[model samples]
Target: RLRAGVVMLIDLLSSVPSVVFGLWGILVVAPAITGVYTNISSALSGVPVLRTVFSGAPISGRSFFTAGLILAIMITPIITSITRETFATVPRAQKDAAYALGATNWEMIRGSVLPFSRSGIVAGVLLGFGRAIGETIAVALVIGSSPQITQRLFSSGDALSAVIANQFGESTGTYQAALIGMGVLLFVITLVISAFARAMIARAERRIGAESV
Candidate 1:
């Protein structure tokens, strides 16, 4: 009952509108991280290679780091849910065999459960990555939509989805095609990632089946 309740709560939270997260990011999280972003940016400026990546005019609340943080929060429950489901599907006999072999609980999880679930976990992670990359409004709201490429996480930058979402209404002719092109690129990237993840899962399943036989 408690577990079910917890799952229900997570589902509710996960289903929240992206716009709400955007607003929350702007009003709450962005401001909260400003000090940390400033400190990190300042610290990294001293190192040569790190300076290139972290160097920018100034740290702003709205940046790639803020958008990424929000995306991570948004996708975490999805990955967690998928991983939990995968773990639940592990064979009872495998667990029993581990116990019979005098494996401790932690050892059984590490040796038996994790090995079995690794592919599923990877798939879940890839799915979460897809979700993060495709997110438009929430990321757009927080990411400070500058079109320039910069290595600094604290500097303003634009993602493909953000560009489409923010500019689609005003964009015309070649600009519209350009935005569509970006969408196509994003779609291709996601498709490739998903396909790779699926292939990994299938390979893992086949290996496990062969071992069992």
Candidate 2:
């Protein structure tokens, strides 16, 4: 019952519109994390390498870190679901074989399931990555939509999707062209990543088939 409820919750979250998530992040989660963000900013202020990364105008909860956190949350269910389904598809015989070899439960999983499911895991992760890269409204809202190149996780920075979404309306000829170019780049990158993931999944399926035969 608990597992079913959790799965149902995940399904609902996955189905929510990106704009709604953005609003929730901006209104609720971002403010809630402000104190934590401030502490992190202060701690990183003195470090050498990290100081540079964390250096920015001011620490804000609605920053790169927050955007990343939101994206992670949004993608979690997708990756988790895919990985769970992939593991579920693993043959009982392989697990039995591992146990017959005196493997413990964890060892059996490590020796059999994981090896067979690695490609699916990679594919799921890549799918999540692609989703994150293309995310526009949610990322734009939480990332503060600033056009800066700071490495500070707590600093406002721009992503291609965010920039295009926020500026396309008011942008002029050159700026609009640039934004289009960015969009094209994002599309090409996503395409390549998806193709790679598909290839990995296919390879895994072929391997499984051969082993089964």
Candidate 3:
């Protein structure tokens, strides 16, 4: 239920200018994390605290996770809508049959709704992922524009979108060509991933149909 809400919100929010969310994420979530603790070194005392709890504590802003979370918020609605619509198409008879067999709600969902709607869910998720991958202005602002990957969720890192968005304006000649090439690469990668997801979903549907028969 919470996830669904996030999805719906994200879909609506994402349609908003990427700049808006980017600014909002940077201003809101980033500062929220920053205010929680001074730094990881201070938070992680010399003592051997439980790895999970210590790791879970907040730190700085502009981290990779923050960027991903912000991106998720932007894309959730698209995924949720697609997933909801997909699930809606599942035959009522299938759900009724499961319920008649004394299946719990979870069981009905898992066995009937999930299997039947797997393709749609996969497609939705893949589309969301693509949106995240290509997101530019919003991610640029929240992601701190750092080029390197970091272990900290709050530590900044650059994404392809950020790099492109940042550099494209100043680039010329070969540099421009290179930037465009990067975009081409991104396009190809997304297309390949989308294709793979579609194929996988198709295969899953076929397998489920065969098993049901």
Better by TM-score, candidate 3 or 2 = 2
Query: Candidate 1 — which residues are off by over 4 angstroms?
Result: 1-6, 55-60, 198-213
lDDT of 1 by residue, 97-168 (tens): 999999999999999999999988998899889888889999999999998988787788999999998899
- Model 1 compared with the native: what TM-score? 0.87
- In the predicted model 3, the residue pairs found to clash are 7-76, 7-77, 11-77, 63-154, 63-155
**TM-scores of the models, in the given order?**
0.87, 0.93, 0.76
For model 1, the run of ten residues with the poorest summed lDDT: 51-60
Backbone clashes, candidate 1: 0
- The positional error of residue 209 in candidate 1, measured at the CA in angstroms, is 8.0
Best by TM-score: 2
Query: What does candidate 3's lDDT look like per residue over 1-213, in tens digits?
Result: 997776666567646887888888888888786655345535665547433233433344766767877888888777878778777767788999999999999999999999788877888899778777888888888777777655555566788878998999999999899989999998888888778767866766676567567
Weakest 10 consecutive residues of candidate 2 by summed lDDT: 52-61
What ranges in model 3 sit over 4 Å off? 1-11, 36-60, 197-213
lDDT rank, highest first? 2, 1, 3
The stretch of ten residues in a row with the least summed lDDT in candidate 3 is 50-59
- lDDT for 149 in candidate 1 is 83
State the lDDT of candidate 2 residue by residue for 1-213, as single tens digits: 998998888888889999988999999988888887767667888888987766563445688888999999999888888888789879999999999999999999999999889999999999889899999999999999877777677788789999898899999999899999999999999999889988988888898788788
lDDT of 2: 0.87
Q: Alpha carbon lDDT of residue 190, candidate 3? A: 88
RMSD, candidate 3, Å:
4.6
